[model samples]
Target chain A: MSTSSDEPAMGAKKVEGAGEPIPPGKPMTMEQHIVDKGAMMLQRLKPMKQISQHGCSFAIYSHDMTRQIETHHYCTRINQDFLQCAVYDSDGSHGRLIGVEYIVSDKTFEALPPDEQKLWHSHAYEIKSGLWVNPRVPEVVVKPELENLAKSYGKFWCTWQLDRGDRLPIGTPALMVSPQGVNMGVPSPELVRTRDLKYNILTEAIRDSRVEIAEPEWLNPMADYWKQHGKGFKIDVEPVDMKLRAPFP
Target chain B: MSQHPEVPGDPTATTTSLLEKATASIQRFGPISHIHQHLCAFHFYSHDMTRQVEAHHFCGHLNEEVRQCLIYNSPEPDARLIGIEYIVTETLFDMLPDEEKPMWHSHDYEVKGGYLFMPGIPGPVERQDMEKVAKTYGKTIHFWQVDRGDNLPLGIPQIMFALTREGQLYDELAQDVERRYKVSFAAEKEKRKDIEGPEMGRHPLANGAGKGLQTVLKEVDVKPPSGTTPRVFV
Candidate 1:
């Protein structure tokens, strides 16, 4: 019964032509009336709390380890085992919906068949290395949240390969993987610097903040696996001294 | 015991060798490193259809314009690979052929109604993101009707998505997702108060009334491959 005052009444029309003669009044069609009512009703409806409202940022890489992208993830917890994330290119309102990610607990990951399991990537490295972060949250709260996220596994598919210069999402969706071990893939130095400057925190410094959060036993299998089969390379894992860097220009 | 060349005679040497082999075996299973994001959401065969299925989507962002998600039956490890969903912007949707246009469903209704949701996202951020998502469109087809208890993906792939409007969605289906996920649609609806609903008339291609699968099927004049009746959950 309630309605917003701003809404235009159904079938209301304004004459536009200054020189042309006005036409005789025409009755609104049944379909037009119905559509207008539906629109009006929907306008007054409130949003649902089915998904979580919080947004977090992640520095993600391509499946082939070719490019690094900074994405904003707005996630909703479905249950104990699953969390669905809506991915975007930025935290701003104009950010594009680039992809979606699903995070599952270790128990759910284990239940997957071998081939299916291979399609999913682990969050252990991201968590342990502190590459994944909730930069918006206060420092005090972020540690515990990061520790909690450390224990889960995530699978990401990026539909828009912006790096390839495709205006629209075309072709197959590429499977994205997290950086592994000390040898996390090549993230653009400029992009990382820009993100770090915006958040005013470094990945290494964030990683160091959680040095005391013990690694769960579930991570052992994957750690051992990476030791054996992971690409043998090393990237800088040093924590940046925040005091030493110049203030943002 | 000392005869084998690989096995050293010294007690310390033997212990070290055994430790090395144990480490090697443990490392053989290796680390999983391809998938980047995980999402769990509900998908129905058609906007007008009532049957809703939960999907665990493993996705990768190819660029700013496209996201490809591999849909699964469940979040469990044994979850079957049921289908793939390709999400695109309005710019992309407009580029598609008329035939291809009907295959994709607009997110306007689903987002405004709060039916299409990403479960782990917080309410405020999700609302903001939904505004953007509402403008986009998705084309999905499920090869497996796993929710119907079919052991294998039976029959031809059926186009599936979320209901566009309130009455089109069955109460039972909405309740089922709510009960399983410990979420309330009523609460979600309340949280989405500020997001403006899509203007239906402006986007004829995205309109739910004429673009639903039923209407599309009628327009195309094709029956879903002979033996299979489109599964409709009460």
Candidate 2:
């Protein structure tokens, strides 16, 4: 039987210990290992089998465009119009799942309520700038995929802010925005240089090849919540009296 | 009249269609290729039992014991992206810290009660999958509140829970799912009778049983990136 290296091994260790260890404790306990092994043998993880695409990019905090982090996306295309990605801090075997991103076609995005549209950001700039790339796949195999993504929009949420030096996922989830352009002062020169160097590809060369991927004219104005509105949401935990809205029952 | 008031249709519709087709023919679309299962179920807000919404789970396995799912409000091509759920075995769930356990919900009830089903798959095949799912646990957070008639996902993400026993799920909701999918919950429940649940009862704290849990978002101050002067956006 051929085993795919990308597949998480049975009894895989829980992804932890990135950044400074808050409260700094010892490594995984013995009991944790045993339980993981037992679960590996007993459970059938049927949902992870479909991660078909891998892309690397940078994400800026929606509330603070100055704050940025490199993101490794393991995505599963739900259909021609939608794709969901599990965002990690790295592409290594031990990368932690820091957030999730949902990508939809312009057709799907445009249909959203105007207020709702602000939560999403367009991908055209990221694709055309060569800031978003699938490192493992050949350019020929990935271009068409980029072509489709060029006109798409994505809503990203990061549970763990490793860039902010958070020891673990704490506080409320933060919304993330895509890099718009170099002139925007996001996705710094160092970020692009490191990614290109690590992956052995030239961002400028890739950018030149993607000249045909035009920006969609009908792009929603409210999209890119932070940039367009000059303000963004900052999520936090608060106590509340919960009530049920209609149509739920 | 347009079905969506926000979208008046675009003039580039024809060129966009051609570009999509051309890309579809050659794109590898590697990331989404492993999605092989679509399980339909209902999720209620953890804070309120009376509020519930249909969840269409498109899942893929990452390993023998861990699975991740992307939940949609509907099964249609234009369905709204609502939430995400991560599933793990009882063994793994047992390893979680006491405070963390409450965030995860058990699948025993969702499976045995027949509230979960794979649309269009053969009963036997789906039953086998459900049997495996019965002993698992899931943690879900819904970003979009479609039930509230929100066109776009708004507000804070809320943690969600699964129905654990009889009388928790509304009858009308079950009927609506039954009518659309052409599957009887009663028949599915009967068929799943022989399926064994977790050897041990589900974690007591899971699903916020007998307790109210909700997420309320507050506005917080944003700190600049470490060791750098904050750049002000004009």
Candidate 3:
């Protein structure tokens, strides 16, 4: 199997102007330096402890199918049907926290207003095609979870354009989608191969194992609107008139 | 891994438990180790003040002046992820365009009033961080409306606002949080009297002062023709 770590052919083109590292500023004072060091040691971080699952998957820009990114999800399942994930560029301490994705079951996804439904993409193809995986856990142990996720839908928002080599998170958040099929080359073979090589797993084997996980027939027609309408949502900053209210003196 | 007895009909529960143990390990969650602060607060709908929701913020500092947070309905293990809040320093907020300022709400009121707090950290230790937070401004978007009793997060995302003045927050809600967390907002507010507010004063357009704002999702070309940006409808 090819183990090339080269960038995808599409990423060669600069999408957004890559951000430069923040320039060094004035040196910190003795007090500023000591206080900064002390703060980290004194506080107890409890909320971060709630994250209970890790899965790796690939996503395409909902607005443009050609742009794709590998997502590392550290998730918290609020119930049997709902999950929220903190997505990163890699499964390492230095990986950029690029975005967040929320997953809901078929019943929940079906309940959303049609326009809202357009913002989410189904996980059926991702699961069955072996594009989504839980790393480090045995397949037997992770099977049930994958079964639940296969019937789910996700709404992902990307804050950092790491794929374009941006040094910092710039621009408005971009909505993301899961590739519904291989026909459009959304999850390009190279991308899947890169991930498979890194994890030491075989995509074809995983795909064979997930064949019994039946696809849900209740998928909302409006979901994955990018594919359906050939259009996507784009967020931007535009100028506006001012309205002011005075504050307390 | 801990063992579980086989259920009457279902058979995957044991494997599921083991899966949970594997993923929950610190080694597995190492990528998100930077999430080090937990701030509990409340948010009211930007378009409607009467619709209030408690927000528990699990945040990480991206730099000295910026922090990103995941807002959940509660701090419990099964808490619902209702929204996201991005906090920026006055410097960064000032760089935003005039039209974008209204989307952000100042933290002065929430922080100084003790309406925002750290759950398990010591008061003195947490207070130091709160001092920095007091000068920050947050732009929040809530996807789930727990107050509306929606079993799941539904409809389009809504812009959220922080309480700017006293009495704007519901009395019953504050009392309930006080009762459950065993922390008095009144006392915390009194102790935080010395934290300074922004030196340049609050942005007039912030907190949706005179008019409220709501997010309207419109379908447009993902990449608009070059040099022409889509018009934003407020």
lDDT (C-alpha) at residue B37 in model 1: 41
- Taking all chains together, the TM-score of candidate 2 against the true structure is 0.68
lDDT of 1 by residue, A141-173 (tens): 445445556777776656445544434433333
- Winner of 2 and 3 under lDDT: 3
The DockQ scores of all candidates, in the order shown, are: 0.03, 0.15, 0.19
Candidate 2: tens digits of C-alpha lDDT, residues B1-234: 121112123333454445434444444433344344678899988777777889988664545566656787777654555787777778767765555566678899889988998776767657667877899888787877777765445556777888778887878888988999899989889988888778797777666543556664332233335545444442
Report the TM-score of candidate 2, chain A only: 0.84
Per-residue alpha-carbon lDDT of candidate 2 for residues A1-249, written as tens digits (9 for 90 to 100): 101001222222333444334312245445434433443343333334445567889988765656778998876555567676777777764455567887888988877777668778889889988889887566776676788889999988876555654433333467788888633436788888988998899889988888888767766777875554456665543223445433211
Q: After superposing candidate 3 on the true structure, give the runs of residues whose Cα lies further than 4 Å from its correct spot.
A: A1-19, A22-47, A94-98, A107-116, A159-174, A182-185, A189-205, A208-220, A234-249, B1-15, B221-234
DockQ winner between candidates 1 and 3: 3
| Candidate 3 structure quality by residue, lDDT tens digits, A1-249 | 000111322222353443333211223345433444454454444446667888898998765556788889988765556777878888875466677788977877766778788888889989888888888777776788888888889988776666765443444556787876743425878888999999999988999988888888777768877555667775543222222222211
Q: Indicate the DockQ of the complex predicted as candidate 3.
A: 0.19
Tens digit per residue, CA lDDT, model 3, B64-114: 676777787777655766777878778777765555567788999888899
Ranking by lDDT: 3, 2, 1
The stretch of ten residues in a row with the least summed lDDT in candidate 1 chain B is B1-10
Model 2 chain B poorest ten-residue lDDT run? B1-10
